[model samples]
Target: MTAPSAIEVQDLVKTYAVRGRPPVRALDGVSFDAPSGAVLGLLGPNGAGKSTTLKILTTLTRPDAGSARVAGVDVVARPAEVRRRIGYVAQRPVTDPMDTGRENLVLAGRLQGLGARAARARADELLERFDLGAAADRLVRTYSGGMARKLDVAVGLAHRPEVLFLDEPTTGLDPHARAEMWAEIERMTHEERMTVVLTTHYLEEADRLAAHLVIVDHGRVVAGGAPSDLKDALRGDTVVVEVADDGATARAGEVASRVTGLREVTTDGRTVRARTSASSAVVLPALLAALDAADVGVASATLARPSLDDVYLSITGRAFEAGAAAETEEVAA
Candidate 1:
């Protein structure tokens, strides 16, 4: 039999009011489910209600409408019990610079109701597991950004919660640091069997880490499934043709569409992109020949296996980067 869902959200809605401005609807009937021990990614542009959803799940705030359950407890009805079973690592670092890593962890443990002796043991174990043992005695101020972030995660786990919520855990880390954090997160889920709900703006991070993905836009799920499945559902390779001038793009698209098997021909400036079930070997030659027949100058051409980026473009009719930028601008306004 399948395990019950570790997290379940149904038609969640939330609205925020600002001075002299209309109330903004942050969540509009958002819903998804994640099974136990899975890394579920809430993938979206900035200000797309990803954070708002996280807050509701973690019981930081109540949803204006709908229901949610974490670890089988209703969030609105049993928030205190839900809180006990979950750990939250926010987008910002919460550790105190003046405290050593060990001290910070011990404090977190104590706050979670562990006695002094147990808290110390848990802190030591986590410090070693997260590779912060060498720097355990050093002030958190002296740790690198990666080390500090790891500590932040370790603190969240000090209570040995069943579910962990990570909001943009790798946001500010450098490439190397982000890689290390990813490895640490993998270890947590694989070794400890922890269920993780991760919110991220980084497309590559979600693509690499999530066992299941829920793509949100404008406070609703636009697409969701295993990353590979979502990409596979698009059902074709993508062909991109770059022409010499914007004038050639329309003709290039028209030519590409005429090739049997190619679908969704779209033109952007001097580039034409299409999808085809045929292999690149079969599609490239036919596509090039068709464009050539149309007298469209092909400066370059390439084919790529379907990707999450492509899936986003196809489903949303906008590129991920562009949507992210728009979300950011909306937040600022």
Candidate 2:
């Protein structure tokens, strides 16, 4: 028989009251299942309820409606038990700046009920595993951003919980630091066999780290599946043609549509786009010839396989960057 799901959320709803204004609906009918030993990404823009969902699952907040289970225990009914079985690393660093990394880890292990000797041993083990052994005795304030973040992850693992929740794990790291963190997380899941639920706004991060991805938008899940599967479902190569103006764009689309294998020919400003199952070489020449016959000036053209960005655009009818900006503005308001 298959092992039980490590995390499950069913039609979760949560609302927050605002002073002198209507309550905001943070989560609406959000649901997904994360199998054991899988890294599940909860992906979305700001204010998409990604954080809210994590809050509920981590037992930091109560859901207004629906049910959730983590490690086979109901969240609402036995929050303490659920908390015991999960490790949470928030978006911001939670390590005390004045404390040494070793101190923080030992304290965390102790709080989780490990004895003094056990906590010290666990702290040293994690320090070595996360490559913090060299600086383990240094104050957290002396650590670099990447080092501090790794320490945060180590603290979360101090108790060795069944499931780990990481909220925007690489949000503030530089590209290099982020890459290092990604490697660490990969080791955590694959080598250590830890189950993880990671919420992140970085599209590439989800594509790189998650075994399964759930894209949430405006308090609901818009799409979900393995990253490759979601992209494959779009089913063709994306051909983008850049033209001089609206007239050229329109003509380009008209010309592109005439190609036998091209589908969904459309125009956005000076850009003309279409999808085709044929190879780019097989379709490019015909498409270029058609545009040339129409006297449409081509600025540039590109052929790419379908990606997570394409899947998001197809389902949401908006680009990921645009949605992210909108969500940020909404949160500010």
Candidate 3:
């Protein structure tokens, strides 16, 4: 028999009141299930309600409508119990700069209800497992960004919670550090068999790490499925034409749509983006010719395998980068 879900959210809605402005709806009927012992990634832009969803699941805030459960406990009615069963690693560091790495972990363990002696043992075990044993005695202020991030995650796991919540787990780390964290996260899930729900802005990261992915936009789930399944849904290739003149985008899109085999054609700024089931070998030439026929100047064009970015664009009509950069204040508000 299938095991019960680690998290279940149905029609969750949350609204935030911004002084001097209308109240912003941060969540609107958001719903998804994260199976036990798997990673569920909340993928979206800065203001797309990803963080709001995490807050509700972690019991940090109550939803205005709908319902949620974490580890079989109703979040609204049993928030304290939900908190006890989950570990939260926020986007910002939670470790104290004045304290050593080991100290931070021990304190977290103690607050989670471990005895003093057990807390130290758990801290030592985590320090070794994360390869931070060498630096466990050093003040957190002296550690690099990556080292500190690992410590933060370690602290969250100090209690061996059944489910872990990670908000933007690798937001500020360097490329090398980000990769390392990805591998570590993967290892922990496989070995610990714990449920992890992480919200992130990186398209590739979501594709690489999540067993199940949820795409949020404007406070709702636009699409969700296994990462590979979602990418495969848009069969064939993504065609991108970089129009030389910004003014020609409209003409490029209109003319490109008339071309055979092209679908989901849309324009963003000076670029015309679309998808086609035909192989690039047959479609690229026709696409360019169509643009040329419309007198649309093409700086360059590319055809690539459908990716998470393409999926997001196909569903949302906006590039991942544009969405992330467009508006960044909703979560903060």
Candidate 4:
């Protein structure tokens, strides 16, 4: 039998009213289920309602309509219970600079009603687990950006919650720190057996971390499934053949089109990429033959399986990098 859903959201609608402008519909009839012990990626570009959806699920804010639940407790009706079972890490860093890392975690646990001893013990354990043991006694103000972010997450997990929500967890993290955070998150997912709902604009993060991927755009789920399944749905392998000059792109596509199993060919500048059923059998040989026949110079050729990035672009007509840029713009504006 299938396991019961750890989190369920149905027809959730949330809108915010600006003082001078019209209300923005953040979540428009959004729906999805996250089963126990699974990582569900809530993916989308900026203004796509990823944060709004998370707010509703964590019971941090009320939805204008519809309903949601965490661990079977109604998000709106039993918000306290929902909080008790979930660990929430917001998109922005939320750490008290006045307190030491250990003190912050201890305070969080005590606020959750744990005994002083238990809270201290939990703080110590998490500090070590998150690689902050040496600096546990240091004030949060003394910590690096990544270290402070780690403390924020540790504080949220003080109660050993069964569900965890990480909103853009690696955002603003340096490359090395981001890798560390990824490892830390992976370890927590396994050790705690927690159901994680991760909202991220990073396509590779979702592809690597989430067991189930859900793509949301403008507050609607446009795609949902396992990463491999979604990639497979796009069909076959992709062969990219780069030509020497700008005029060679169209010529390369024309050549690739005549290839036996190639389904589609697209040319951007001097690069020609094609989706084909048989990269080995029809795509490679036929493309090379055609290029040779046309006297076109082949600089390099690469065959790769489709990635979640390709799938995202195929569905949304926008690249993940573009989405990331838009998110940054929204933040800046």
Selected candidate, larger TM-score, 3 vs 4: 3
Write model 4 residue lDDT over 1-333, tens digit each, in one string: 887899888999887776787877777899889988878998888887788888888887898899998999999999999988998998777778998999999999999899999999999999998999999999899999899888988987999999999988888889999999888777766776788899887788898889888888887888889998999899878788899877778877888888788866767667776777764665687788889999999999988889887787778766666765665222111
- Cα lDDT listed for each candidate: 0.88, 0.87, 0.90, 0.84
Error of 2 at 67 (Å): 0.2
Q: Tell me the TM-score of model 1.
A: 0.90
lDDT tens readout by residue for model 3, 1-333? 876799899999899988898889999899999989989998888889988888888877889999998999999998889889999999899999999999999999999999999999999999998889999999999999999999999988999999999988898999999998998889778988999998888888888889999899999999999999999888879898999998899989999888888888888888888888676788889989887887888999998889999988888888888989997767553
lDDT of 1 by residue, 188-219 (tens): 78998889999887889989989999998888
Q: Give residue 131's error in model 4 in angstroms.
A: 1.9
Candidates by lDDT, descending order: 3, 1, 2, 4
Query: Total clashes, candidate 1?
Result: 0
Model 4 spans with C-alpha error above 4 angstroms? 19-22, 241-260, 264-273, 285-300, 326-333
TM-score of each: 0.90, 0.88, 0.94, 0.86
Candidates 1 and 4 compared by TM-score, better number: 1
Give the better candidate number (2 or 3) by lDDT: 3
- Give lDDT for model 4: 0.84
lDDT of 2 by residue, 5-75 (tens): 89889999998887898988888999999988879998777888888888889888899999999999999
| Clash list (residue pairs), candidate 2 | none
Residue 17, model 1, lDDT: 83
| Poorest stretch of ten by lDDT in candidate 1 | 324-333
